[model samples]
Target: MDSRSVSSRLRELVKFLGTVQGDLSNVTGPPSLLAPSSVVEVGHAWAQRPAVFAAPALESDPEKRSLLVLRWFLTSLRSQLYVNGAPGVSIKKPLNAFLGELFFASWTDEEHKATTQLVAEQVSHHPPITAMHIADREHGIRADGYARVEMTFNGAVNIRQVGHAMVHIDRYDEDHLVPLPDVKIRGFLGGCMYPEITGTYQIMSSAGFVTEIYFSGEGMISGKRNSFQARIYRREDTKRREPLYEATGIWSKGWTVKDVRTGDVLEVYDVEAPENAPMPIDIAPLDEQDEWESRRAWAGVLAGMASGDMRIVLAEKTKIEQAQRQLRAQEAAEGRKWEPLLFRSQEGEDHAVFHELTEGTGWRLFNERTKGVWKVDESKVVGAQSPYRGELTPLG
Candidate 1:
């Protein structure tokens, strides 16, 4: 893509992210990384009305105010990826290439910042909402000597995906770990909640490669409008380790990682990708899911590639390992195992019911209206009859 087009697209994203709000509840990995209550709470607020806080709001919600601060930081650091360019290190898709790893790397880290008066005018808007307030703390240099930066964490130190990375901090040694809720974290949390994102950049990354990927989606969450754009970029990394799988769905599944060029397909369990399913399932892995209750780490390896002085290395692909299986134990019943079988007899106009048997319940009926919850003794449900193998797929 040319500098003009890339800049136009990103500017739109910035505008859009500015509008929506989202909550990123730390679903896995560590509690210390983000305050449990706040992660979800704040993330939801940001995702829902992200734009409200982008521009100054005369009358703003308190929660929205805090989110505005966080957004500022993300926007700024994204600008830096491009600014940090040397001669051949051309910036391209400043945000995508620079922060790809932190968020979810799908391409080589390259510069994509455009150098133009209008681009500069657009970027010269605001500052990041974060900063290293303390001198020495959390891996800072020297016992008391620290090197703190005010760079864009282009990535959110908060927020967690439903089935991806982000786990409890307590798992890795509770004593040494400090929860994000502690006042220490809140006060120093990115520091300077005042101005967000270091004032916009007049410049961006210098050189980089962009992949041919595009994504567009719209939905309603909790009765609010939602949308997203997935930008993918990749450069020939003969050195970088090829992914275990080709991300045929990357364009649709947000930013993702894969070893499309490698000989191995990373598989920790025996499973099959169910037709039209978001993820594959395996009954075997479910048994060991509890061990990773609080945390589970994936194997992240560096694929060797050369980019200038820094050896071109693919970012680590670490995700919160989750066990997805039908729980034999019923959520309602104490110790009984629920079966996955469904039985029905013709009644009325072919009325049918779906049962999600768990450990305790015996043939519990599902309520379609109640989101398939088997809480009640039985609930009247509709649309449970199979269409006799005749299903209408998405419209072309």
Candidate 2:
């Protein structure tokens, strides 16, 4: 937490960035810059607590549940934007996920008495895509998605997230399509690297409802940081002139939901409170996880980082990267492509799936890409069970 240590960490990260730049210049594929821990560890940073997905499970009404889902999604942005623990905090770079690396965790919602499980896998390395699946069988809710980032550096770092997520509630037989927002990393050269999320995203439900969200940062003359506004509309209404619900607030702080027609405030989200605190995810014991599992694979590197020994960190990190490179080379020699373990990709048919899910609703999939839509393997899910209990372990 000391400024000197923070500065030192930033310097180290910048040095790693230089290596990445050089590697890219040489036309190598994505450079591996694994921090002292696993990329799976970085994933935990996104949802420091687990309750984000639990909100929908707690809601019984389809329409109200959709609103809760949107709120949960917005709340997650707080942690996602401040990955280095908090604003202005300089932390080590996140570990780059290796192909096929798996991360599994689960959390129990004490209030709802439901268990939520999350399964994430690094499905692709060249484009660095991660596939994730979350399920709460008790509440008949599930979500599946994939994430990939395209980054560009021009004074400030701009990151465009390319992915879509689908949340399904069996009770309502509704599917919610969620898109990610763009991110900007500010003050890189000034030595205060922090993330600023910007741009518009949408959440469309199969129940003829659509929520349009706009993200913005503090302006010189007006606007506060992490400001966002969302309007929900019923798709069947052709004019789209009136919204059913509206929400406005600073994402990091909280927000208020209002019934637009009645002009009555419905709910307020106070994210900082202990009752609304993030649910803790339980990870399987390191020894029980497979060698390809995130925790076990990066155990040495994590230990090195905890001990503040960069020598050990680098050695372990290099070993993992080298092994990955060798595996790729061997696969190429054998004329084989690495296949994902838990997700299946469908090319040119993502829009079809979107249509199927949002059939009755007027909402259409926007910004649909051809990188192929990735879906969880239901067969695998049917057989797999949560590996951990309610007790959460330190990520390191």
Best by TM-score: 2
List ranges where model 1 is wrong by over 4 Å.
23-159, 164-389
State candidate 2's TM-score: 0.84
Worst 10 residues of 1 by lDDT: 116-125
Clashes of 2: 1
Off by more than 4 A, model 2 = 1-37, 41-61, 238-240, 356-371, 382-396
**Residue range 8-52, candidate 2, lDDT tens digits:** 655665665565541121122212223444444434533344455
> Would you estimate the TM-scores of all the predictions?
0.16, 0.84
Deviation (Å) of 43 in candidate 1: 25
Residue pairs in candidate 2 whose N, alpha carbon or C atoms collide under 3 angstroms = 50-279
